[model samples]
Target: MVSVAYDGDEKTIVRRRFLISGIVQGVGFRPFVFRLACELGLSGWVRNIPAGVEMEVQGTAGALDAFQHAQAHDLPPLAVVTSSVVEDIPSIPERGFTILPSADGEKNIQVAPDSALCGDCLRELFDPADRRYRYPFITCTNCGPRYSIITAIPYDRPRTTMAGFPLCPDCQREYDDPLDRRFHAQPIACPACGPRLRLLDGAAEPVAERDDALTRAVELLRAGQILAVKGIGGYHLAVDACNPEAVRRLRERKKRDEKPFAVMAADLATARRLVVLENMEERLLTGPESPIVIARKAQNCPVSPLVAPANGWLGLMLPYAPIHHLLMRDHFQALVMTSGNVSDEPVAFEDNDALKRLSAIADYFLVHDRPIHIRSDDSVMRVFQGKPLFYRRARGYAPRAVRLPFKMPPLLAVGAELKGAVCLVQGEQAFLSQHIGDLQNSSTCDSFRHTIRHLSGILEITPQIVACDLHPDYLSSVHAAESGLPLTKVQHHHAHLAACMAENGLDGAVIGIIFDGTGLGTDGTIWGGEFLVGGYDGFRRAGNFLPVPLAGGDTAVREPWRMALAWLYRSLGKDAFDLDHPVARHLSDTEKGIFAAMLERGINAPLTSSCGRLFDAAAAVLDVRQAVSYDGQAAIELEALAEGAGVSGTYSFGIADGEPLVIDFTSLFTDLLADHAAGADTAAMAYRFHATVARAAVEACVRIAGQSGLDRVVLSGGVFQNRLLTEMVYTGLLDQGLQIFTHRLVPPNDGGIALGQAAIAGWQRGC
Candidate 1:
């Protein structure tokens, strides 16, 4: 450490100190820096500091300049350098580059998300001569699990789940060598000293070991038997997608009837045979994230229809885990890799938990010894307007910080009841949890609590403020109320608007069009279709849809026929049932009379202006689906029916100009009824109805923008999850010469609402 070097004249000596932030630690950044310094003939020492990575170098001016230039362009694949601060220092006598131990300080460094297997690692994994050949736990610094196994920081092996396994002598040699790829790779292990896999039957007794275990799992999959395979983040219930009987059996056992299942393909070539992929979709499928990309199904695809019954698009993902790669490469072309959870429950992650909970569904279990500290489901995405739109952000994307426009105090935001996710904000970064499923069930609720605790503990954040939705009955709201922190209750629609605003880095006022199934309104009714003018701190309701009775309340959500009756009665009076419509034929006289009495008397009826209910009513009226198996099923089917139809006509609506503008759909319903009476095609009417809604949204935005003098419009809420409707509204607003913002990094659904709640809480507290 005392060697000093001066290449030429003493006058040419120079020294610089640099501080790098953002995912610069735990990703072989120090080794990368050491190699660069050695090659440039510069002497430097790099070490991990709480703020990030710090380095000090002394060399000739030319060598220093080259090093600085390369710092920006060349970096380890996982090192995301967000900011770099450089300062000139007096030349110090240093001879060779060195990697020093990490120093303790205030923790501000970003944790890297899990990465896909890299090309070099894959080559070594498949090479027969390599020591780690066929090793499922083989990993290196450039590619491997990171966020899922981390317990505490400094990003060292002692602080990770791998601490229990001591490295073999040869592996330790590679880990200590600066030139080796495994140097400082916390999860590095060989087959001799790493986690092992085993195949177990329903009784949880071992049936096979190592290579034979994988072979047995493949044979079971090929024989149309479901196997719960433990993966990097969680467990996946795997079945052959081409096996109709197996898919149907799994669906029955899992109680998932119509929801589309995500499939894992062996490789890119295999994925192409099942779904169409564009350039952007291809990149997302094969990229480090390796999220499931929603794509249109290929013509004459070999997969069974039961895998994604009545769905036009299929969720496809290329293998990201080594075990997944090994399973698919030899046995099958595609496998149904759905989450290992019953309906409305969080995905199972623990080995014992998987055995106990999934034994009813899985014929066997292919599990490992490595522990997953926090469970993360596979992320789902779709390509829209030539860019990626996240539906569920998890797996290779969770726990990564989203930089805020301004600093924030420590805060926790419990997200919506449906599609639940929590947020922890510290300083300028907001760390959102992975998808936590709906919080209605006790198992999911417990998982949500565990996720909050685990994420907060690892990120070292203790919130002074707790935020939740205005709905008091929501599970998230209940959790926040009991948190014992200062609380802020954000309006549901406002949170949706604020989420889009925060993600886009907009601080000023914008016209927000929030449409969804339901949210507790300020007036004690239900709000779904709303127009608000607001910023992060607050918002004012500017417009909304006209109220209609939701007959039977929650029961109407399951049976769209109920919504159809409510809408028809409100639009066409007591004689609505006398009209010759398909909905009339489905409802009995006695049932209609009872439903009519409930709506008239307001017994068990809640007034709502929900656009989602409107879509459901239309689907029921058209006899497309009288009952739904899941949330948004009716609307999803309606959108699919309208996909390929060529229709330009749209219904008309009346807007009542007032303090809170009212959008009346009576005329639109009247037009739709006339078309139905004239025997208009259901597909054409569905397309026209979607177009009407899109046009109405643009008109409402224009009216709000004109009155409030806010020309920027932000589209959010679950209704915007409809691709056709979102695109139409986007193009319509842009054609009107308005600045429009939609979700990109965060989802448009409730999964992203926690970020908004945290932002609003921080802004309200003046943090």
Candidate 2:
């Protein structure tokens, strides 16, 4: 029997009302609703409420059905729709859907965070005939500053920083027209009525205006003069890359050393000449965020060697703001754009702060009058495994919450040390903050707390539980504890695996290999090398690096000799290893004696299975590093030496019980000692060590995969950030015809830890 069901007639459609809560205020949710309503030919009104967006629709049953589907799936990129309740309303004789004035007194509004101007706005800004042409603040519904402009909820012009500047009649017309992209774009303004740009000399005297000011800024850069150029979220000291003196001067004045400075090139062509660009990389460089940094180096790229000379790759991002675009258009192709601050300090945002604090760094000033509410840094990205991984998520890619597959109660997660980011979750939406730097220092910790509060306000969530790294030494963890929210401690390696799983949308158990510098192990040891079989809810420890004594604790991080002494004791015992090489002279006799005693007695010593420490020991064995000047110096120099020596044959790493017995390296050390005795190149030894380590990892994975039914492997942790190791793993995994997963959207490093924390928290809550 065929059954036919009818609701009134095909033309008479039922109208339903919906109120969506969480991240639905300033992030273009209303604009998205307008588009969907128009597409579905629905009638009634849609408008913002203090708590969220409220909308009513009337249409054919199928049309309403389609609209509902699109409402959930076709949301704007920045919108994080947490909850929506649809109630059937009596059919209304409404002709067409229209945006209504926001209802006052409601309290669930989700203030959208500011986004960089979209491509559509850029097109209009360059259209010579447009009124907003050459405007520094050109914006549309699709993009332009949102969270930065907002002062209160309900996200209207009256409740924003833009409220001070009333829209002119022409702007009003464009803003009122629903058909236009600029319709209801609160920050919209023409050059005649918007913020103005000005150039000033060293003494703070005005030198030029508008386009001329921008042109002068470029000219100053070409002349090897340091100019403090105002950007979207803060000010940056800009200098010509070709000028070694300018770079040196800027670095000295900013009190920066060794650490690499980021560069901003004019466009794709200029960026291409400086670095190799892949298709996805090219698209990322020119896309809305324009954050993508290609890691390949240029052949004598004209930039001073002092600018990231120790590293092969240069950090490059394109001009995203109008002032930047104008400044880059003039003859110069690239500018050295580092943060305007002393090393380890926050980037300056205020006008007075820039002029006062950056006096020594900047030779000139390019000032503007658009009040910046929140300070943000330029987002940094890199291409790995043909995918873009974000190192720093700011500017072009922020406030855009990542939606979870399952819903959960509100939770906040304070991420790990180094490349820190905080996360706030409401229902299924997880909003991760922009890069919050190392929290070991007071300044960075302050930024971490401030950013968390600001992001929490935007998402309109009061976290029920706070998640943090199990490591108590991390300042972020302490801060999370003081917040008074229920604290949930997460294991570091588990969080790393969980982050990869969440990004890949995997919920089942899988084998995970996490390798990094160090983390507090569950058994009260240090872990940075681990293999586990797990899901977000829990994990079973399958294997790990064998722990060895660490001498001088923190001192081991700075001196490879300390780690080398410990490894030698483990590999060859107290009397079997030699320590009379010229490299041995680098350490003080007193220090060497202390290290040997510490290893033998285990005084103030801890054991760790960190693969990173293992690399440090090998690097030290080959005399790659003795006294380190920076973090990861030994490993970095080792990789550089290996790069020159090229790939070699596989080495063996035996399995004991279920775990891999890391070939103690005593034999390898003996061979290296013999080679040194025969006057062999130390570089080849370094290369051989790296090749051996990679082969060991591959072999271990092969055995594990065969024993377990799971064939998929997830490579995670900061250690995988090494290019040589990553390539070796990728090549070996593919050769085995196995599916592999690595990080793409978020970093594989600790920077991506917050997302993992959120995922685990959700699973814990039975989401």
lDDT of 2 by residue, 571-619 (tens): 5565433356534556676766666677788898898888888888777
Output the lDDT of residue 210, model 1: 89
Clashing pairs in 1: none
Residue 71's lDDT in candidate 1: 78
Per-residue lDDT over 698-764 for candidate 1, one digit per residue giving the tens place of the 0 to 100 score: 8888887888888899989989989999999999999888999888888888999999998899998
Query: Which candidate leads in lDDT?
Result: 1
For TM-score, the strongest prediction is 1
**Each candidate's TM vs. the true structure?**
0.97, 0.87
Candidates in order have lDDT scores of 0.89, 0.76
Q: Count clashing residue pairs in model 2.
A: 8
Worst 10 residues of 2 by lDDT: 1-10
Error of 2 at 247 (Å): 1.7
